[model samples]
Target: MRRLDLPPVWLLLFALAVLVLSRLDPWSLRLEGAAVDLAAGLLIGGGALLVAVAVVQMRQARTAVLPRREAAHLVTNGVFGRSRNPIYLGFVMLLLGWVLRLGSAPALALVPLYAWVIERRFIRPEEEALARRFPQAFARYREATRRWL
Candidate 1:
């Protein structure tokens, strides 16, 4: 069976849940305003930019971008130097943007859950792979870098 459990899959599902919860709104808590729109726009834009930069960096290193895959190189420069898991961090930013767009309490709450899932499913495994593949370098990198930022 194919591994359907992935970050993008959960991102989409959580986004859809945000939409549904926005409408159902059992909590009746909604955020609305011009500021909210501006914040959402910024988060979405920043997240997209961050993901793009990280993907480009990984590709330049000739490393795998997907989770639970072997990487050819240990990329510890550019955005990677800033955050160890910038892609997942970007994904969370995107989910936060979606929550703000939906403007529901339940929607906002899902962002952390999405982060947790990505960390458990992707980040941890990816880190282990990196540690195995580039033991000394990864140990140094991990010590200097934060997992998420």
Candidate 2:
């Protein structure tokens, strides 16, 4: 079987795990408040928006967004200029929103874990490939942008 290096797959797995663990209510903090709900909603919405922007930028650049694929161009504008890995940042935000919605402190731990795994599994290699493909441009972009913002 092909190894699943897709960040979305990992996101889904982590999200499902959070959902299941939240339902279990094991050592969970059930904070019921309108503020919490609003925050969660904002996080989810903002994260989705960021992901959309990143994907659209990549598409416009005619570059491959998938980690396993080769990129056709170096996209260093808009959201890409702000964060080199906006999609991953968006994914983290989505997970954080879910954690807040569930009010599960244990589930909160998954956010960092998700970020670390994504960085090691996808981001690092993709950066290396980007550097190889667009040496000077990638270096400049890397210097100008934060990896996750």
Candidate 3:
């Protein structure tokens, strides 16, 4: 399979879709309560933090940091030390937050579809490349970190 790179455009589009699908129609299911807002904020904050950590780790590794690509070095330290796919994790968190804020059940359904599409289209190819590039190191890292958390 070709490289499974998801460009910024596609990521943004997916994010937008999640937001739209989950948006609360004030007339339907009003989400004006502070509790829901707090939960949404926490989710958004967590997502941002995860993404930031991933970016910092990539910079430290001196790698391209694209989901469709493999790092020149197997980054098994820092944020990578904990999760194999921090960026994806962040996106998933963001999706959950979006759904919470919108109070939409349909939005939750998209979460599985998003995960499946990403795993099949992007993650697998990147893993294969990483294995070829850093076989031993990648294996060790894989053994240590969970693919998703």
| Model 3 C-alpha lDDT per residue in residues 71-130, reported as the tens digit of each score | 778777777778888887787777778777777666667767777777787677888888
Tens-place lDDT per residue, model 1, 1-149, is 24778788889998998898899997799889999989999999999999999999999999999887889999999999999999998999998988887788667878888888888878888899899999999999999999997
The per-prediction tally of clashing pairs is: 0, 0, 0
TM of each candidate vs. truth: 0.96, 0.94, 0.82
Q: Where's the lowest-lDDT run of ten residues in candidate 1? A: 1-10
Native-to-model Cα distance after best TM-score fit, residue 102 in candidate 1, in Å? 1.4
Per-residue lDDT value at 101 in model 1: 77
Q: Residue 54 CA error for candidate 3 (Å)?
A: 0.8
Name the lDDT value of residue 111 in candidate 1: 86
User: Tens digit of lDDT per residue, candidate 2, span 9-89?
Assistant: 999999999898788876656755899889888899999999999999999989898887999999998998889999999
lDDT of 2 at 100: 86
Candidate 2 regions off by >4 Å?
none
Off by over 4 Å in 3: 1-8, 23-33
